[model samples]
Target: MRRRLERHLPRALERLAHCIDQVRMWQPGQFNYLNSSQYCLYLYFLSNTIWREERGDEAVGAATRLFLLNKALNGIDLFYEIEMPEVFFIGHSVGIVLAKATYGNYLVLYQNCTVGKNHGVAPVLGDGVILYPNSAIIGRCRIGDNTTVSQGTGVINRDTPGDCMVFAGTAGALVLKPATHSLVADFFRV
Candidate 1:
């Protein structure tokens, strides 16, 4: 696991660097201190997680401590910063909160979805996960691959297994079925 994570670290760092460059270009001088502050916070989060997985024991205490410090210093009302795999945002607006511990790939989070910490628990999302507008997933939970969390759905303390369809209702239910590719492709046809 450590080896796999180590291999991906360079790519993650590159992405972070790219984001910083973009921010620098746009703001010029406004975000100098703010950018460094956020960068340090993100680095602290990433390093501790990596260290815990690799060395163990030594890295366990740093993440929580740093997170608390970040919140106190920044005066931001929201807590939780999402660390995502290599992916670009198609569109993003303000007021987005993503938890540090959540793990996922190819995630697309539209504006206003709060992926937050629920009693120090973080969500584990699978690949190709899309959280539509106003969707909130909190606590220790797993949302499966290829799943679309519809708008205004709040999920807590649950697991949506792989290849399943989740819908809201009085008695909310999930159906496990293979995703059909051609059906999805039809939606893109001009």
Candidate 2:
């Protein structure tokens, strides 16, 4: 694993650098191998780089191994194929499951947050969307930019207006309100 990661380190580090740069709490040029969050991103970057570089079985095997390693160590289900933005933040990597959805830039996900599909249709999240702990966005929904899915809230098969807003409660009885402040700004530099 170390050899493979080393072989792919340059490209992976380039991608990880783009991601870590947007985070406010992280120092410039910081990539800690011992930090689980940073390592999780590194593994994802390596897996994705390998997958994008070739279609051979060896590539697939290596990517799958890296993905599994990330899942095993970080408890995150971010696949190599998921096109995560270059400037997103993972508050807590554990128990976060992201499906094949149209994620936007500056996406923020906390522990136990889920972005999944329903009937083969995925959600389309706009820029600066934040999924708080235990929140979910499922199926054919268009989550607007700077939208905050409050803790324990679930937006299933609905659309949110593209303004600074907060979503609370389940899909059937969602409560939408203008967000008081920019939650994304707190997590990211932009």
Candidate 3:
């Protein structure tokens, strides 16, 4: 496990730098321990891919998940085999899907968000995707980069373009629109 982490350290470092950049930290190293969320997310992916086939390592992975994330159990508890890039954030870690055969990068997930298979199909998410609280992306959908899935919205069997936002309409339907604000810049404010 240490060897695997060592091998992936540079990638993690780079990703951590990106996270620090996102937060606009003056010192990158200090931002690493600013909170435990970043480390937990890193361990979440690591526990799934690197230690998936190992028993002892998986045990450590289970402990990590249990200690950090609330929803995951039994060794990472990933819904599917996912490949995610770095500098992503997962809020509350409840019901957020780790891709049921999908890929993601720079993804941000809030509480109760799900991104997995609706039937037998999975969605492919691009970079800088944000799944707000209580949102979902399921089944054969394509989510482009810098897209925001707003609160209380769910996407199924649809394709969303880049630099857009998905919000719940008056009648509880999903509506798409051009991104008016900088997603990366105004994310925390929203």
Most TM-score-accurate candidate = 2
Measured against the true structure, the TM-scores of the candidates, in listed sequence, are 0.51, 0.94, 0.69
Tens digits of lDDT, candidate 2, 70-101: 99999999999898888888888999999989
RMSD of 3: 4.9
What value of lDDT does candidate 1 attain over all alpha carbons?
Answer: 0.52
Sort order, TM-score high to low: 2, 3, 1
lDDT per residue, candidate 3, 1-190, as tens digits?
4665566556545555665455432344554443545555555554444434344755556535433452343222343134555456655554555555555656777777777787678789887788898888889898988899998898878889889999877665679999987575544322
Candidate 2's C-alpha runs over 4 A off are: 1-4
Better of 2 and 3 by lDDT: 2
- Give the clashing residue pairs of candidate 2, or none: none
Stretches of model 3 off by over 4 angstroms after superposition: 1-27, 31-34, 52-81, 170-172, 187-190
lDDT of 1 by residue, 1-190 (tens): 3554465466546555443333322332232335534444344335544444444443434434554555455432233234555432312333346677555545555667777778988888876666677777788888876666667777777788756544555555433345554221221111
